[model samples]
Target: MTISRRSLIAVAAAGSGLLALPLVARADGTLDEVKKRGTLRVGVTQAPPWYSKDPKTGQWSSGLGVFMGKAMAQSLGVKFEPVEVSWGNAIAALQGNKIDLMFVLDATAERKQAVDFPATALLWYSLAVLARDDLPVKTWEDLNKPGVRLSCAQATTVDSFLTKHTPKADIQRFPGNVEAIAAFQSGRVDAVGMFHPPLLAARQKLGKGKLVVPTPAESVPSSVAARKGDTAFVAWIDKAVGEYYRSGQTQKWYEQSLADFGLDPKTVPPIIKEMIT
Candidate 1:
């Protein structure tokens, strides 16, 4: 079904959790509590295209996952409250039982120890590179040489990606994207590795960097996360996510989010083109 902007808002607003009922969990865990409490607590982060906040007002708005979370809650007849979490804390927040759902998570083996994923990927993302246009790096091989400086967020997928793929590069590690971007800006590093959409935002901020979806165009599946061990709750979420894909809501909102963020539709990472399948 085609979704209008008005319908998107009304649905998201309906589950904004402004009037949360008292949480009452059934023996089934979060699924029952979500339905009973009338609020689906969704963990969000400042990751662009997934979640973001206005710099001036600090008011949060749509990221693809935010819209998807709203739809998932709507399907369950519950509202979803966006709970902010840091990238470093995403796993801990879920493991500690701080949030009922993680709207965007990759099903890595280490993470699967703590959380369960749906049978299908909610989205796919390519590890992207943002670099000075004039850098000698024109291919993945160029960046895989000694003294070719690269920046990555410590403990993030990009860090491991670069470590594995560009081992000879002098990889500088920082606590998060802010520091990684700063490192790139100050000439401490020649390039930065992360996902594409956020790299697009970084390109705009830096004003002259080139966006590169490294050759071979690799991408990974990204999924939603729920605490492990509760097969019933996990199965319910799996079915809900599967239905979300079937309804065509995913593509509609994904395009809208890209437009809202001003990313060039032509340059969207290949994984985006592969999402609906």
Candidate 2:
């Protein structure tokens, strides 16, 4: 799976036809193909409580993302292979055939063009503004005020959304969420726009930070992604996700993962059980 520049350009030109090629096969069955091959390679970020490495065990253990991946692997009878990827590289890694799936990604219309999303909506996330408590910022509208600096991850859906919705705000790009948060904490940026949980977790750790008064103006559904033409695998994922949601394990995983991260389980939205089932 060595994707060269020329090959990428060629694939881009062919587009749908290129995507239809079978990338991997299941061994014992359509599912075990991944297991017999050794691991279900997953693309994830270093965001703690979402997808990060564990210091004590020298293994990866994060939030619902890893939990979902493990569940999928187990249901499919495969081994889990968590690949640590930067926010910027995650999508590219998927496109370049470096990994089998991405556990977390906003299912924006634009992204749907490149990847296939399973029927289940993994989570719903709100874009939040995090700023110093002393700042005059109070709402999403305040973020549009003159001279306000905001930071978001490069090439992320959030960046695109902010650019379209809040064109007045100066947007800075960070390689990943951690650096963006670091910049905001150091006062290098006036505000940081990111998903609710991690930002809320940061606020709790810092004590006395002002989360913009009003909630996110827009909410986006997130989902697991596989290569565009992996129909059988994608169908299996849809069925597995459906069964997981139906069995109530999905909600349980969410509650336990949030609790493990010291986040309030109440903050998690009700699982959209209907979509998966």
Candidate 3:
């Protein structure tokens, strides 16, 4: 199933919450605070290919977010400091000033109530599945049969999506991506479900599987999160991230992260929508 540029762009345009907006110049004080503090605190968690902590060094070593955060900090002439925060608490961290910003957070309507997100999208990730090579799937409906088994992290967006769309399938919910992917690797499930970026690494590591974004493709643009009402900071982040996307730097960073994870970039799906085919 090859993705045409027109189709991918249409899928991307289906969502409005995280897409870039008109850059209104504002002087929100968060930028000044970060400058005064001499460090830009970025919220991070152990989500590979996006955010990860090195076991040996106990540092936020490599990932797309790490690269972007460091670049943003450097551009501001400050240090990049990664503060530990779970996806659940990232909003709280921004609200309470525990961190100055968080990268790669989706700008959902629910999340918009708590924190301000930049108008510019940090990157795009789509709901995709890594299915056994034998299972021919062209769409989500193709996997909605009673005998098919799909695995995903419990209580995640992926699980929720699978549950809603493929209710007849044997949807096995595991504790996390590792367990979900393990189920597929062990031949207990026909496929492992997650956003495309994480599944890319899994596919490379497993050395087999077909990665496909089902028809009626669902894609979301993720963005940087700042404190609510921090218009200036958000605008600044928006401009910087927009530049990254426009100049193709975001793809470079993502490719580097995949390489760092020991995956060949050619074997994985790209984060950029236009590069999907």
| Model number with the top TM-score | 3
Name model 1 segments beyond 4 Å from true.
Answer: 1-26, 54-59, 95-97, 133-191, 243-252, 273-277
Please name the candidate that would achieve the greatest lDDT relative to the true structure: 3
Q: Write the per-residue lDDT of candidate 2 for residues 149-178, one digit (tens) a residue.
A: 888888887788778766898888899888
Instruction: List TM-scores for all candidates, in order.
Output: 0.67, 0.62, 0.74
Worst 10 residues of 1 by lDDT: 15-24
Q: lDDT for model 2, please.
A: 0.68
lDDT of 3 by residue, 53-148 (tens): 889999889999999999999999999999998887776667557888898888877667556888777888888899999998889999999999
Reference-based TM-score, model 1: 0.67
* Residue 274 miss distance in model 1 (angstroms): 2.6
The predictions' CA RMSDs to the true structure, in order, are 10.9, 6.3, 10.7
Alpha carbon lDDT of each predicted model: 0.73, 0.68, 0.83
